[model samples]
Target: MTTGRPPRSPSPSSSPDPFQVKRSSVARLPPSTIATSYPSSGHEASVYAGNRSITPTSTPSLSVSSSTSSDDTVLDESDDHDLHTALTSEQISSTIRNEFGYCANQNYRCVSQHNPEKPVAEDEIEEPPYYILFTTYLSYLLVIVFGHLRDLIGKRFAKSSFTHLMPYDGYAPLNSDFDSFYTRRLKQRIDDCFSQPIASVAGRTILVYDRYSEDFNRTQIYTGTTTRALNVASYNYLGFAQSHGGCADAVEESIKRYGVSTCGTRLEGGTCDLHRIAEALVARFVGTEDALISSMGFATNSTVIPALVSKGCLIISDEHNHASIRTGARQSGAHVRMFKHNDMRSLEVLLREVISQGQPKTHRSWRKILVIVEGLYSMEGTMVNLPKIIELKRKYKFYLFVDEAHSIGALGPHGRGVTDYFNISPSSIDVLMGTFTKSFGAAGGYIAGAKPLIDSLRMRGYCGPYAEGGAPCVLTQIIASMASIMGVSSDLVLPTSTSTPISESSVNEVLMPSVADERPLPSKVPASALPAWLSLPPLLSDGSEAYERIRRLAFNSRYLHAGLKKLGFIIYGHPFSPIVPLLIFNPGKMPMFARMMRKLKPTPVAVVVVAYPATPLVTSRVRFCLSASHTKEDIDVVLRACDELGDLMDLKHGRGERWPIEEIVTRSVELVHSI
Candidate 1:
């Protein structure tokens, strides 16, 4: 079957590097090079330089201190050589921009913190035109009707293929038609749009492999080509997914010293000093008393939640919480209940019902009532009403578990998640769960809470004695990234100014104590919490770069969300959320949207489309995960493509005021702040 439009032609360059992506055709973006100048301080810069040059001995010492300039940090010399060689002569004269895009405009930046004085009124979800909805229903109906007819004929005429789907010789069928219909029929029709392989870093731009389907997507034939596409599909939220950077450099150095695996579980001799150090940094980052790290992000919830509640305990969860949360809740064997997504009233009603009615049948009081919520919903992009939840928690005294998987490093001026965004004390929430995979560009998850609670979970949780500890490199990524966000303690105080790309005033606005006369010191990464051997550049070490990332992500997220709305496309979620979901009400439009966006002119774009099980049948959408690595110009490219395609596909059915795509692109800074 035809995948869509013919794939874009490959780059003219015949360079051997498989992962190098073509630069954008819309406009040439400036290179985003990290500044290498060291800050003048009492600490010697040579110390960090020495640390980066050390070779791993048979037994490495724990107290080694090292450092290096950004110019010298190279993970692979050949990779860099190949990358430069692949570029044209004109491009070779200038710096080859890394995956991280550059934008120095301070006007685009916005503080994500919520001001209680100005409560946010949720934007009403725009409805598509009636004709669009009517046609959408018709499309699904025809597909289902034709699918059943085809299956009937296939079973009657093609018995050999149907044998596994039906009982044969006293053996039960492998799968009934009812069980596999969606996967075998409806989903199979559009399978090519789902998992297209990519060859580059999942940053602002990605190199997507070009392919075509031979047997209705049963098999795909790679054309031995790739199209460089603007990436609005990945979860590299703060854009730490780079091949070259302070974080990457530190990770490479750590691999040399620690040699990857810790060799065992946390409780069975697998634990390293890095584990303890990372946990300490995590606890401090989230403002929790203590924390425990798990090897996998999914297992962090799936395994530990059972230890938190069971049997008579009640688990009140949001209807749209991640599957991992649901899996953990099921394993806990708790009496589970769900409230409407982000509906505080529904939550309150459910809390009252559970508190008043107690356990079902016996009517005995529940052993414990834990309310679980996501800091940001992945599909919908809505944030939990944290302030109101705190209000309910005070009234009902239920323990709260907030999963900050997407929000930890994406939200707030300080990048501290929902609690920071709303200016609520982290201590107010009973449990804080977050993953390193999303923003830190690492491979683990962490659960932070009271020291006693964490200590208890570490010993009793399912992951304690069985799961392998996080790899040393993964831990190094976490430590380096986290420390970058939480700058190292220093006497150098850069004066606050409005002209600065990331101003101290903006940081102060988010980090300001809720109470007057109770000034809290900024949460700086302790020098001792990091591996002594780890070497970071001045910007990463000082936390300036991370602050820029936080602001840039905030800008990109707001820009895309606002720009799409301006172009008259129905969308869902908060303006500040990185995950922007544009509603594709008609099922037929889902694949078309993906195809058009990917095959868009000059620069192809990668996007993720969701339907059915991930969302309601009617509300299929294309999710755009914005990143700090994207510049304003990158967002303009996306907006322009959406505008052109939206016109072609009749997707611009959104109501209210609309702006021309050109105007939206020009006035982006105003639009972001307005939103």
Candidate 2:
């Protein structure tokens, strides 16, 4: 199975050879020498790092399916998985919103233990710019070290493998190595991409989304300001963040029982029955025999990573894997190698290297191997090629850990995720990790697989040792039961079942909006409705609570997608689901684009700005998430705005309201009142 660079996008392959790629994107990826060259003159830096992307030939194509008169019908259950996944991501992304940001702002007033050296705003004194930069840099560095420390500590413990960076830090100008440079570069690249806003003393904002929103509604999140000229972005898939019943319910429950702080680790007071139950239910839902719950999906990866690989072990990872996996792999004292995204050939090359090292007994020290991948690549909105990778796992004898954070309820014939989507036996995978936060519309992550494997990881994984509490328990149990229902209900839970990707006909039959098929449509169900299948009535009733509302949302999403696309926006996620990412070029254009969107519609969407660190510069886009709350009329307002913009941009049709607004104002007499 040749899975290296993504397959050429339908027609011609634009993928240059590896050497060429190395010269362009991957090469500049600071080698161990960045310590010698920390960009001191941030002021003199390139106004733009320049958005760039190196899409593999094997990456999935963004093929659009247009509707004709005859195609109106219920989309098949198979495509329902993505709608669920899309909605889930949308829900999470949306949660990063204003109220959350407001809460974060409020929390800032509290005293801080870590940074006791506080800078009071006496006489409105802003710290010197250089000092601020230094503080910010130190903060970034701390995050990098803390985030990747597991790798550093692992190497030291192994003696034969790991290299300690702390000791090297004091060496010369700095302990410059591939590891150091890599970690630094990761932070630098991300920070540089989202250059801190130029506001003099803007409020530090952190959107505090109602954590429970992941179930059925998306929470809209805003990181900076409503006024921050729009170049920044978020993951809002369904826009459920602003308001959603499931999200509200979950947040209410979490605050009520957990009361904000565990004060200690899960093993300490943190390990409530709530965390334990969630862990078990999540494990089963994701098709794993067992699971370990974590504070976050990322923490799950961070902890499980180094715990699994050791001394003579090796880790084969995808080039495009999330930073969490990379961090974990680094901590694992094993030799780490990377394959191109979805590229089986690159993985094979690394596998061969490991196996070819020596004879069996002699090579026993480095015998173990773990292959890790995200169920769905965040930027590409594509899935891991499971079948191709699984073959390698079977042949080479390597443990597989899939980060199904993005795809748990998004893919597979049954919404069982990538593994189930590909029809691989559940036990074939050594470990499975997912988040109840996403698909279930709540917050918390889990790791499931063989019970022994999970148990061992919990007791030994890096964070496991430090964790006091596991995950939220009550939520996970409910999630598990929902997953159980998904297995049986093709119309809502997972897809019916598929050996390959869902067929186009199935998609049209289930997702398309048409009166021809009054039956339940796949596209219209509130992704939150997936787990709510148990709660659904046997007969689909008109205007009922769960099912009735879900259908409306599905219809709204499609209507919104159609309206937005009509205005020349490249829609992502899908109308069937709720995520709609708008395609754009220059990062500079994003803010203006978002503002334009807001002004144009009666109830305009706050477009999320996306650029480099989060996605390739070339892939700069604005995500426009829709929801069940939206009305067909609301979609019309958006479309009319698009029509106006289309005309401004010289598009074929000018999108605008056919009617005009009437306004009245008086200026003469009121002008002098204040004076």
Q: Candidate 2 vs. truth: CA RMSD?
A: 23.2
- In the range 1-675, model 2's lDDT, one tens digit per residue, is 221223223234432211112211111111111011122222110111112121234432110000001111111112122233434432322322221111111111111011224321111111223443354456547645764674566656754333343454455423544556543434333332232233211111122111122322223223433232111133222222322233333334444444565531133433554444444345445544446767666788877777776656667788878888888877767778787767667788887876666323564434456788887666544456666677787677667888887666544334456665455556666677876543344456777765556546766775666865533333433443233323223443323455244322232122212212222213223222222212222221111222222333344445554455444444444223344555554433444565576443224333455655676534456654443333343344545555565455432222332222111012211211211
Report clashes for each candidate as comma-separated counts: 6, 73
Which runs of model 2 end up more than 4 angstroms from their true locations?
1-260, 263-270, 357-365, 412-414, 470-582, 624-675
Per-model TM-score versus the true fold: 0.82, 0.50
Q: Model 2 reaches what TM-score against the true structure?
A: 0.50
* Candidate 2 Cα deviation (angstroms), residue 461: 1.1
